[model samples]
Target chain A: MKVMMSLTVNGKLETIAVRPGATLLEVLREDLRLTGTKRGCDHGDCGACTVLVDGEPRLSCITLALQVRGRRVDTIEGLAREGYPHRLQEAFDREGAAQCGFCTPGVLLSAAALLAGNPHPTREEVRDGLAGNLCRCTGFQKIVDAVEAAARGEGDR
Target chain B: MDFLIEQPDTVEEAVRILAERPGAARAVWGGSDLVVEVRDGLSRPEVVVDLTRIRELVEVRETGDGGLSLGAGVPLEHLARRPELAERFGALAEALRAVGSVPLRFGSTLGGNLATASPAADSAPPLLVLEAEVEIAGPGGRRRPALADFFQGPRRTVLGPGEIITRILLPPPPPGARGTYLKFARRRALDLALVSVAALGWPDAEAASGVRFRLAAGAVAPTPLRLPAAEEILAAGRLDEETRTAVRRAVEAAVRPIDDVRAAATYRREMAGTLALRAVDRVLRTLEGGVA
Candidate 1:
């Protein structure tokens, strides 16, 4: 059975009809057409579908679409303000952190979440924060450097 | 995607819906595990009751007696960082952090973990050692059961029809007590435990062993088991090499490990003792003024 639910996505209120069993990932990409939130494992194992729910990083692949009703959801699309990219995105681009870009959205969102709580995270802390996100390319050294540089406010947009 | 979701504002309403629907309805917290089950066609419920909205059910509070009451809906992600909980129940905090990744913990709940009743549930061994009790709500009202007696087998518990775990009660740990939870998995990030151990010890000069210890292990048996045999060995006398060897043998004897995809039965049996000893050593070190 489909249910009508309302959730704030990317600072915008969206009222959509969704199946109860549909994951927040599905609703984000299909129903709302916010494809920035990638779906990787379709289970909780992979962090490819991570999103911030009420300011906390949560797995959207396992999160029921109706579960986030009336709650605030921040996807990769919302990580940036207006047309400017988020600091993490800018750092990723400058550091060449993304290889295939499939895991970029989830990785960037998780990095944003980590930095939101700890603005000046150490290299170790960045690795810990991004542990949930998997990157087949670059071996995460560049991603760690990118997050650390972003934390240091190196690349100002 | 074939079910309807019911978000109840209170426990009473949630219980009512569960009672009226029986097997047709199920209560979900975070939906990290249940959602996967539903998606995999392992469970096909007509309705899923989202219990996250019940404010009282997710709050972690201190009991009047200095103990703690954890609402079943409290997420592991939030609980792992709670300094108050970490101060008293350090083993539990460690176990919570040992579970999946940061994002997975955000959607995993203690109650949901207990409800799933997997033998490898990371929270079980610590809660077992902590002597926690579960508050279950059903059509017949509420009943509190010791966490030790809560499980029957894998994916099975004492939960009755329409019964939902509402809260977890943890007694205050002894002053100066030290504990540790150690998990052995294929990979630390997102792998289930092949064998896990939890140990909590407190100094007691009057006791025969000169200390009191609580030991438990996971994934090696049908349920998370309290190591009474190992505890008995440890209580026999001083913490000598012979005593430690006996404790290892006791743990190996107590666990009923089986060959599974993640591990072999013989290997689990051996590591169960190894981790149990390591956990005990860490606890002893902390109790004796050494760093954990």
Candidate 2:
């Protein structure tokens, strides 16, 4: 029951064969080999599979691949343009926001999703915005600071 | 368990697929809950009639009666920020905000929440208190039913084969009415409610009717319930200490809860009354020109 579906990933159109009930998370990690999105909880509880679908933060683990057929999907891999990291990424690096890095992709994308909608989010807003994502390393303070700095259009050297 | 999935861009196409293959087909909105079921082998839908592409099913429009008619696919993430909706429909806003997490909110739809029909569905009690009605579509066209009659039991609804919920219509609260939805949960995020309460009330001056009030409870019974017996007592009566105590008693007596992993029946019964009093007290304060 593999189905041919076209996905618009990282501004590129790619057609691939996927299982009938394959999730967007599976397609991103396996079929397409875009491993930036992690598989956490495999259910909707953890935001480790967070991705931007049409500029909104959505849980890719629960999203069907068919659901995003013609939609824009921005993953952690899509954060950089022309080989430079996204400002959010730079800010996180400069602030030492990532400890384990397992949660980085999801956290970065979740922050990017928030900054896209609210460019000047407060620190509290950044925390509230990324409440879905969990950092097992438990370095939330730095992550929130990184997001706030990114929202203010500040980046690392 | 392998199956074919169909994405119908239009309601007619979706309905046609469902009508022809009702047993094998299932309609999905957000897929937040349903995807887990399919992935876990709990339910293998031979054909998933994806309804997300039906454009008209996801828009939020102003109703003819000055209320809001939420397209079944309206995402909670988009609805929570509307200051007017949050201020006017506090209970629903709170309940919507209480759903899974921010990321889940972006994909989950209001219609999907109602269609799940879980006794603990966070959106049910809020909709019940707001006097919401739902529009169901099938091969025969559409039928609008009161939200009260929608639920049969846990994971069951009046929705027949080939029928899908298309929109939720909510009547405006009284001019001065204040509404609140409160739920007790294990955690602030990604947790199901242990017990939830929704209340809407207004003083005589702001109320279109005499001391209008409505009450509903969730996760403490077989289905989300409307406390008509309690509403009957609060609707026309003056706000008094004894009357408030009576309201709590009525709610406590009305709940038919059972022991579960989330809570014990005794605790749910007690919290039902506690939350009920708190929900009404907040509204009453607003009615008396005090802080809400």
Candidate 3:
């Protein structure tokens, strides 16, 4: 089944044909080639496929492609500015948050959503915001620190 | 695949299409659970009825009768944010808040939770405790059924082939009554329950007359089970140590759990008793006039 969907991805408008069964993760990665939105569990269990749907972190792997019609989607790739790293990306780098980097993109997106919603989130809020995303590396302390750094506006420095 | 139909206008239209094409269509709201089920091949339907466009099903209104009539499409996040729901039906609000992570909550619907019919569904136990009833629409007409009678088994509901749940009616909590919902899981969020319990209490000994102690246990039976025996025990008197112990025993005895990936049968049975006791104690301490 094919349906016409108009979506704004990473600030760009796109009209694409999507199947009812096609997931947002598939469209983002396979159709748009935005591989930054990694496919983790395909189910909602893992946050490895997290992305920003209208500035809110969502599990893209389980989200239907057609469901995002007329909605805005932001992937990790969208965070980059002019070949440079976004603040979140830089923080993840300096704090060594991306140990394996397999979970980095999703965690970064979730953190980005949090920072966008709350400029200065407490440590507990950060923990809660990223609760869906799992990281097998960095023991999660560094990821928390990275988000904290981003929130403090220290990522640029 | 023939085609996909995205009808988001009204429940009447959704139900019309569902009845016209039964096996080919499935309703989509929030898409938190349905999308995953479709992707995993657990469900396959040709036409996807997107219910997010239905404005009527998204409302949460206070009935003139002092009850709450929640649209089936109301998001879990919205339910969690309602002050009245938090104050009057604290257990249901808490259960909604405990579902999945924040993002998932934003996309999960109360109707979706009920339709999924998972025995471990977080919202079921609380809704059961609230004595909630569901209004379902089908080709024939609309029918209302108690939440207890809605679930047939795991992932199965009493809904007809083309029936769509329209609203959930929750009776107002009695004055001086407070409720609490507790779930035990291995992780902090996005985890299924090992065992969940919802307990409501009324503080006034006299006003508490005929006060129902609806106990809904999740993940401890084929479907979410209401502990009539436990409710009977609590109705006898104040929830003291003795009454609490008796209620716990009744809950443990009523549940017939099985060993699964999430937990062992024995653990679920034990936690049924433990969670019932803890929830009763918490409600009594917090709301029942500081009673033990």
The prediction achieving the highest lDDT against the true structure is: 1
Q: Which window of 10 residues has the lowest lDDT sum in candidate 3 chain A?
A: A58-67
The DockQ figures for the candidates are: 0.77, 0.67, 0.49
Stretches of model 3 off by over 4 angstroms after superposition: A81-84, B1-3, B207-212, B238-240
What C-alpha lDDT does candidate 3 achieve relative to the native structure?
0.84
Which one wins on DockQ?
1
Query: What do the candidate models score in CA lDDT, each in turn?
Result: 0.89, 0.85, 0.84
lDDT of 1 by residue, B18-41 (tens): 888888898888777788888888
Better of 1 and 3 by DockQ: 1
Q: Candidate 1's error at B255, in angstroms?
A: 0.3
Check candidate 2 and list the clashing pairs.
none
Chain B TM-score, one value per candidate, order as shown: 0.97, 0.93, 0.94
Per-residue lDDT for B1-292 in model 3, tens only? Answer: 2247576687788888888887888988767777766766777788888887789898889997779999998878778888999889999998997899877887788889999999999999989888899999888899999999999999999998889899999988777778999999998798888899988877445434334456788989999888889877877776667877788788889999999887899989999999988887778677644653
Tell me the lDDT of model 2 at B274.
89
lDDT of 2 by residue, B1-292 (tens): 2567788877778888999987888887667888888878888888888788889887888877769988888788888877868877888998898888889898888788888988989999989988899999989999999999999999999988888888999898777778888989987778889999898887564432356678899998889999887787776466577777888788989999999877899999989988888887777777656522
Please give the distance, in angstroms, between residue B290's alpha carbon in candidate 3 and its true position after superposition: 1.2
